[model samples]
Target: DAGITQSPRYKITETGRQVTLMCHQTWSHSYMFWYRQDLGHGLRLIYYSAAADITDKGEVPDGYVVSRSKTENFPLTLESATRSQTSVYFCASSDWGSRNEQFFGPGTRLTVL
Candidate 1:
């Protein structure tokens, strides 16, 4: 949609290196989330922020970090990326109060070789 999208749609990285993926949205949504989707697997939550200065870790947050200091920008960073961290990262956002309808980004593909 016109709300959210990711960067570096495809990426290749080496082991034990840091990589950062960017996510941006047009609407000033309150809830932003990061998720990774593996082959033949469901979307796994990585991190999410309720608003500026408020963030929380999701199911799989190890080796990954996120910050939402801005209402329209939420970026995810992979520190010391490993082979296991090679996957497609998707960013989503939802309205603050309604807590309904999540818009997904195109996704960033990071490959750790």
Candidate 2:
């Protein structure tokens, strides 16, 4: 039988630790976003930056922090990892317009034990 299948990805970590996830874009986009996906919340925005040195917290930004020092890079850090923070994190980038489409990354799944 000839079939194609995809492998599962996993990330494991301990509590009270710090983890940093990074995102980068090829284009010089002015806007970057970080989102976390959970069971009930679906996809919730964690943080977003309009430009360099300009960042704002999103809906679920309590345990997450984001920084944008350049147009092509945006890194998200978890201050203190917790079991409740186990979720998939996604990073996206877009140009400086409301009509522009946002491109998302493959996503990073982090599990805190």
Candidate 3:
């Protein structure tokens, strides 16, 4: 991928099944994030990491887990996928520069049944 990208761009899974969304970046930005976007709401943060091995929960972190073992990857997992967790997942990276603009990946569209 050129910059940031998510794997399994389209997924359909059943409830109680485990689902993991993958995010990768080529820029090696210090900050990475996972977000979910639904129909009526804005992009809600799931988790973020300032650097490798350093991560924190965001606004809506329930039913989700994240880890940054390497600088270029930040993956989000749902141990027991639920219907409520179905949404478009986005991966982003930023360097916290003067502008601090986040570069987003082509989102993953997940459907839970």
Candidate 4:
């Protein structure tokens, strides 16, 4: 597989619980990103990593954490899930920069009850 994958594809958890969503890519792309897409809205960046050991927060990084210790994997964790956190989480990767074409994974639908 030369693309990205995310799991679990769907998750339902109670509020205040911690959950980690996994993302994996085979291309070892230089840049990886985590975004959440709510209904009828554009994707909002949560976190991103330039390369191994290099990570940064994006526009809506609150309550979310990310790490890129490995070049091909970036995981996102919700410290304390809230109803607002319930959305479709998409994982994407690019060669570099915001202008680079990004490839997206199927996505993880997280529901916080």
Mind giving the per-residue lDDT tens digits that candidate 1 earns over 28-108?
998999999998878999999989889999999999988888989999998899999989899999995674789899898
lDDT (C-alpha, whole model) for all candidates: 0.90, 0.81, 0.94, 0.94
Please give the distance, in angstroms, between residue 21's alpha carbon in candidate 2 and its true position after superposition. Answer: 0.5
| Location of the lowest summed lDDT over 10 successive residues in candidate 2 | 1-10
User: Ten-residue segment with the worst summed lDDT in candidate 3?
Assistant: 95-104
TM-score attained by model 2: 0.87
In model 3, the Cα lDDT at residue 100 comes to: 76
lDDT of 4: 0.94
Which lDDT tens digits does candidate 3 get at residues 26-79?
998999999999989999999999999999999999999999999999999999
lDDT by residue (tens digit), candidate 4, 5-101: 9999999999999999999999979999999998777899999999999999999999998888899999999999999999999999999655889
Off by over 4 Å in 4: 97-99
lDDT of 1: 0.90
The Cα error of candidate 2 at residue 39, in Å, is 2.3
Which run of 10 residues does model 4 get worst, by summed lDDT?
Answer: 92-101
What is the full ranking by TM-score, best candidate first? 3, 4, 1, 2
- Candidate 3 stretches with Cα past 4 Å from truth are none
